[model samples]
Target: MSRAEELKQQLKPGQVYRREDLTPYSNAVDRHLAQLVTEGVLDKIAQGMYYYPKQSVFGVIPPEDEVLVRSFLKDDRFLLTSPNSYNALRVGTTQLYNKRVVYNHKRHGEVDLNGKKFFFCKTPYFPKKATPEFLLVDLVNHLDSLAEDREMVLKNVIVKAKSMDSNKLKYAVRAYGHTKTKKLLDPVLVQMKSKAHVH
Candidate 1:
């Protein structure tokens, strides 16, 4: 196969690639990339970023948020979430938000990737995956940004906190909570611990 053909052959569907990643496959990487994009072999999602479109019965599946962010940041250590996920806690959060939040060690502020917006938060700590307890702590951390009734949400949060594993929730509070969140949740967790001991 020609150098350009070999370059195209290296692409796999449902994957995102940085320009540097494909450079080794072709000497004339830019010309090859431009041709591939024009031929619909790839989509230029952003500068220096390309995605090989994956097809399904539903048409082309957009690059996954995980893949997109992972490539954009060039770092795999990121937690992608949004306020919309808070609704799963059933703590009176019903609003659906379009915002996608990324917690990572690098990149802070909003960025656009493939026509979607991601707000990158550089945090010192974030679990590889979010646990329910972690989400509770995060909810309180970002309460000010939420559109729901704050007082009502707090009331429900306290009640929900009671039903969760006291030890796990307490650790989450200490590790992930803001000063105010930690203060609000500590007393409740202590009460639960004491009550459990009493029984």
Candidate 2:
């Protein structure tokens, strides 16, 4: 088999790859990649990023957001979320956002990957999954950015928080919440504890 065919066989559909990943297969990497792009076998998404498009009845399916972002970051230690997710928490938020946010220790600010805009927030920590309490705290952290009424959202957050698992909520606040989130939730969490003891 030719070098192009070897490299093509190695690439899975709907997966992203950096040029460095193709290095072992061919020394004329750029020429080979250009040939593949011209042949419609690969699509270059960004600098040093190429994607193997997956075909479907409708047409080509873009790579999964997590897969694309992880390949771009070259790390899986990032949290993928959107401000729109706050609506699911029933915190009175209703606006849908076009951007996805990635919280990671490595990068900060907006980055364009594969034509999709992502806001990378540099943070010391992030959870693998979105927990109820974590979502509440994250909502408060980014409250000023939301399109909903601030007072109404805050009220709903407090109401919903009181009914959540006190232990898990406390853990989320300490583990994931920032200074403002911790300060805001501390008093309410104290009250929750006091109420629990009395009951």
Candidate 3:
């Protein structure tokens, strides 16, 4: 088989690939990649990055957010989340956010990958998936950045904290919450305990 054909065969639909990832398969990787783009076999999402679009009844489908970021970072050690998701917690966060946040050990700042903007936050801590407690902490941590009433949100957070599992909430605060989040949540947790004793 030709070099281009071999490389194409190796690519999976709905997957993103960097030029370096195809190096082992061909010597003229760049040229062949351009040719594939011209042939509409591959969609060039960014410089040196390509995606094999998945076909559906509607049309071509872009790679999922996590899939794109995992391939772009070339590592799975990152947490994918949206601040808008905090709206679900009903803590007075109702505005929608355009960008998704990626908390990872490497790569800081905004990145435009495959036409989607992602904010890569370089932090030492992040969980594989966000828990309710973690999400609460995260909401408070980024409260300043959100287009909402901060003081009101804080009050709602305290109210919402009442319904959360005390042990798990404490653990989440200690493990995932930042110093400010800890400080804010401490009183709420204490209130939770005080109320518990009353009952």
Number of the top-ranking candidate, with lDDT as the measure: 1
Model 3 TM-score is 0.94
- For model 2, residues 1-199, the per-residue Cα lDDT tens digits are 8888888988998899999999898879998999899999999998988999999999999989998889988999999999988888997999999989999889899988888999999888889888777899899888888888998999889899899999999999998887988888888899999999999
Candidate 2: clashing pairs of residues = none
Local accuracy of candidate 3 as per-residue lDDT tens digits, 1-199: 8888888998999999999999898889998899889999999987788999999999999889988888888899999999988988998889988979999998999998888899999989888888888899899888888899999999999999889999889888888887899998998899888988999
- Assess the local accuracy of residue 51 in candidate 3 as a C-alpha lDDT between 0 and 100: 93
RMSD (Å) per prediction? 1.2, 1.2, 1.5
Please say which candidate is ahead in TM-score: 1 or 3.
1
* 1-199: candidate 1 lDDT, tens digit per residue: 7777899889899999999999899899999999889988899999899999999999999999999999999999999999998999999999999999999999999998999999999999888998999999999999998999999999999999999999889888988899999889989998998999999
**Model 2, backbone clash pairs (residues 3+ apart or across chains), number:** 0
Q: For every model shown, what is its TM-score relative to the native structure?
A: 0.96, 0.96, 0.94
State the lDDT at 36 in candidate 3.
89
Q: Candidate 3 regions off by >4 Å?
A: 197-199
Candidate 3, which ten residues in sequence have the lowest lDDT sum? 125-134
Residue 136 lDDT in candidate 1: 92
Q: Runs in model 2 with CA error above 4 Å?
A: none
